[model samples]
Target: MHDLIPFIPGSVNDVLGSLPFFLPEIYLTALFILVLITNLLFGRNSEKLCRIIACAGILLVIQRDYQQIQLLFMSGRLNGQFLFNEMLLLNRTAINFKFIIDALAFVLLLYFGWDNRLKSHPKGLSDLYTIVIGSVLGLHLMAMAVNLLSIYLAIEMVSIASYLMVTYRSENAFGTEAGLKYVLFGAASSAMMLYGISLLYGFTGSLNLFSGNLLPGLIQANPVAVSFSLVLVLVGIGFKLSFVPIHFWVPDVYEGASTPVTAWLSTLPKIAGFALLINFLRPFVYFEKWDGFDFKLALSIIGIITMIAGNFAAIMQRNVKRMLAYSSIGHTGFALMAIVTYNSTGIAALTFYLAVYGLANIGALALATYFANALDADDMNSYKGLGLKYPAASVCFVIVLVSLTGLPISAGFTGKVLVFSSVYGIYQQNHNLWLLLLMITGALTTVVSLFYYIKIPLNLFLKRTEFVKNTLIKSQNIIVLSIIISVLIVLLGVWPDFLFKLF
Candidate 1:
């Protein structure tokens, strides 16, 4: 206690220094509170106003962060600086992730605003916006956190918001059930993570995961104990990642939640979660050999299993949302493969893949939602005979699905190429057979995905079913958004360098 007293204030100057770097998060929190007040005072009429406010707030933060990002990357200020006494990182990588998440939040806000189903309860829209904005703030925290305590806090913040958002449609039984499942699983994972943290702290007597003491302490400890604690800790990160073993919650939550909500769930948490994941493993870089408890090899194996499970499971899904749920699980595995590259090149690849994946995912889910609302259907069977009737929507769906399948002339293909190349590079440098097998599994799964991914287009164009009604549903907004996303996907495909250079 006496020794800890001296570390309390953390050099007054350091506290002040952290403020400047922390502006983006502070700005977001202030915006959240301001919007909440406005939401309450103005009632239903302020729903759209609050959305506008939220979008403007995120855009402002992005613009400010962009300037800082440029400065950090260009000026070489990222020489391992820590903020708030090593509680958070101040680096280009964290800034890049926050930018991506903020940008994604803006897109999601637009989605929530324009979605007719979400708009059913006017007052509820305000609550949803508030929750989403709060979640974005949590994402900012997740992006920069370096300490175990910070990591747990950020995860809880985002998880709580996600739990509520999944059940936003409280009137729907499926939505309620999904929310319950998420809450229960999240609680159990959080408890396990906290216990793991306590054990690690007891061993190391420090909270920082990447600090000097962590590895030394772990190395000195009993191997079985260290590995057990690490596995328990990883449970928290894996749930957010929705990879194999911890992935049981994804399909149900995705299928039960509204499409726009599902879109957010599929993309944002995974992005932030992976960022935290990389930092968590940085301490393990001290290993002198690949003989025992190799985090990289373990993750590679998990990635292989995840890709196989996700793709195979997707094939059996009749519901489009559930299929995409499984598809996302597959992509999660693919992203994990890129992760084990664990270097600058791998970071670039992972970042690019996530950006492209986020855009493509939102587009695909938007199209699905549009179809269900427009035709009163969510099954592949209902999509029969849709191509001729709704040419634009069906065509856009084809483009999104094609990108997702990693086909030619699309961003997803380039993303896959980048990830596989990174994985292969690791295999070459280290001669890790696990990575070799992972690369092969990734390739095979991509082929298998084609069968399921194409089912939508197949049902729309080839299979014939009785056309229920020729009447049109006004889904111009969804179709237009989907088309925009497809265009971006193709443009990125043709010039992968564009996004690659940015990251």
Candidate 2:
């Protein structure tokens, strides 16, 4: 008891010190509460106020994130600092991830009500704004989490928000079904993750990944058990990433959820999941004696399979959103190629690639909303000749899809090149067969992606339809923002330094 007395003041000092680094997330919690209060105070009439508040709050969060970035660079603290008893990390990479997530989230918050179907919800979008704010907080947590307990909690927070967002349109039976599926899959994955965490804690007697006890304990434990536990944890992160076998829930969820919600589901969580994966893998990757799990081989196999499956399956989808869903899976695989490299250059490339991909994806889905509002079109067959009818929307769709396909003069192209170069650089040094296979698979899948992505433009511009049922264009906001995103994509592609310099 006497010895423990000194620890109390130290713990208090740690919590107090963590607050500054945690400013963005603290603001997010307050934002969430503010939005909820606005919702309750004004009921359905709170939509606009909630949106305005949420958007403004996110921008402030982004500003805070920017400041953190400056502090990291200016203070020469490139190695990062630990907080909350080393359960979380405050570092350049984590800060960058939070910045990207918050920046995209600001756009998404503005986008939520732009979807005609979502805008027509009887309960209004106030609840959605609240959920998104909360989720952003969770996403920030995921980026910084260094302890197993924090990781599980952060994931669950975001997962719960996702469930609510997917099922927001409860009147839509399809959406409700998708939400049910998401919850079921999410629960199973969470259980596996928690069990894995339990096993690790039992083995190491510590929750912190970087703690002195973790690696030493794991090195001494049964290798098979350690590997199994690690794989199970990946199961949870994989569910968020929507990669390969864990990806079955993606298409159905994307197709069934509102376009804006699908946009959110595909981008932000996946970006943060990658951040989480990097955090989880870092300690193991750096420990030279640790060979309990071959992360490179496992991730390479997963990447190769994910690329092939996502791109090829996309070719068969007629529904535009569903096709984008598969396309996202393919992108996840491509990003994994960067992760497997496990180097500074690879990490930088991954950050840029994910940012570019996330922007293009949100733009693509926004166009989906645009057409759905303009012509009630959702599938390729229904898209025939609407290109001429709505040339701006069609052109934006083409540009975004071009980026997704990694064609030139688009950011996606630049991103893919960076990731490819990073992997090849690593391959040159190690001559790993897995790296070579990943590069080959990535290239082949890029070509395969063209087949499906091209189908959109072909239907939009080539296939002629004489009859059209058109509606008032209520999706102007979505169109305008998508065009801006498209221009940014091209700009970043042409001058990769615009984004690369940030990293």
Candidate 3:
């Protein structure tokens, strides 16, 4: 009975002492409040102002954290230690992840504000910007969460904001429906995770995973029951990460939502999900330290299944947005493969892939909206001969697609190579059959992914059709942003060592 109670102990002083390391979050919280106030004071008219504020805040945080990350790299020291009585951590990893989230937010807001469709919405985009700022705040915390309660809260924050963003335009039935589906799925996952957390607290007698009694208690718990509960906790994570078996929500949600929303969904949440998952598992994977079940093996199995399922499913998609949705699911699996390596190399690889993935996916979805507006069609069939008429866009789209397919001369290729190297190193060390299986699955899926990704280029070039008037993505900023992102993707591919050395 004593073990059934959660032990959560911390003092006010502890939280106070941790404030210095929590500056990134504090900055976000302040900005969230400022955005809210700005929205209220200016209402719909504040849309541009709010966007500027949101982007500026995110950029500032990015600068601060990036500098900190650089300092940590140069010093070759980890600044993250347990903070707030070990409920949160402040380390180089968390900082870098925060930087990624903030940087993506900054870029995304620029796209969102520049998108004429959203800019023309009657209610305006002010509220949405506030919501996004809040969401990033949650994700920032999610990356740093080391306690069960904090993790739960962080997931809820992101989920709630995502639901709102999906349903922002009540005029769009597809988006509203997607929002409803997301809510139902999100709630169920959260409930299941809560139950799992309760079970963990019961077994370990502590809310903190690394607490004195938690690990030993976990080891002594019934292996079967503990494994089941642990997986239950991961249900929420898998949902966010969009891994297979828990990825049913992705495609429809991606197709139904607007491009900017889809880009944010596919990138930030997934990165934070994997970061949290890896952080939570660190104690177990690194040590023969605490083991009642083989979590690493379980993760490996999921990774393989996700890669095979996501890539194969993408082959069946004709709608470009939905195809990329499934493609994002495949990337989720590839990320898991990196996470499974359970070391610094794995972390570096994961970080690099996520950075490139964010850039390419954002650029791809942006191009999707551009094409949809230009051709007035969402399917591959509509894209025929578009390459001839819009050579620049078609070429850039090809670049994005090439990167997504893990082709050479793109960041996706470099990301794949890094992951393969990590997985191979693990196999060499352990000769683990499971590791071997994941590696093979990852490689084979990369080849299979080529078929679907090729459809875009094929449609643009091979199939011939006349171009329609496209008013959707006429914004010069959007076009320029897409090209710049594509350029960065190729740069990262060619100079992978540039970022790798920083890590």
Q: In lDDT terms, which candidate is top?
A: 2
Given candidate 2, what's the lDDT at residue 106? 88
Candidates 1 and 3 compared: the better one by lDDT is 1
lDDT: worst 10-residue window of model 2 = 470-479
lDDT of 3 at 125: 92
Best candidate according to TM-score: 2
Assess every candidate by TM-score. Answer: 0.96, 0.98, 0.95
Q: Report the lDDT tens digits of candidate 2 across residue range 1-503.
A: 89999799999999997787788889999999999999999999989999999999999999999888777777677799888999899998999899899999989988887888899888889998999999999999999999999999999999999999999885468778888998999999999989998998899898888876988999999999999998999999999999988999999999999999999999999999999999999998998888788888899999999999999999999999999999999999999999999899999999999999999999999998888887788899998888888888889989999999999999999999999999999999999999999999999999999999999899989999878885767577887898899899989989999889888
Kindly list the per-residue Cα lDDT of model 1 for residues 1-503, writing each as its tens digit.
Answer: 99887866767779887786788888998999989998999987888889899999999999978877765657567654578878888677788788889988898898886666777763559889999999998988888888999999999999999998998875478878888998899999999999999898888888886666766777777888888888888999998999889999999999898889999999999999988887787767645532335788779888999999999999999999999999999999999988888888888899998988988999988888788778767889899988888899899999989989999999999999999888888788888888888888999999999999999999999988864665446678887788888899999999999879977
- Model 1: colliding residue pairs: none
Candidate 3: segments with Cα more than 4 A from true spot: 1-10, 70-79, 466-473
- Candidate 3 structure quality by residue, lDDT tens digits, 39-114: 9998888988998889888888887776666555565556566778888776777877887788888889988866
Which lDDT value does model 3 have at 367? 82
Give candidate 2's error at residue 493 in angstroms: 1.0
Ranking by TM-score: 2, 1, 3
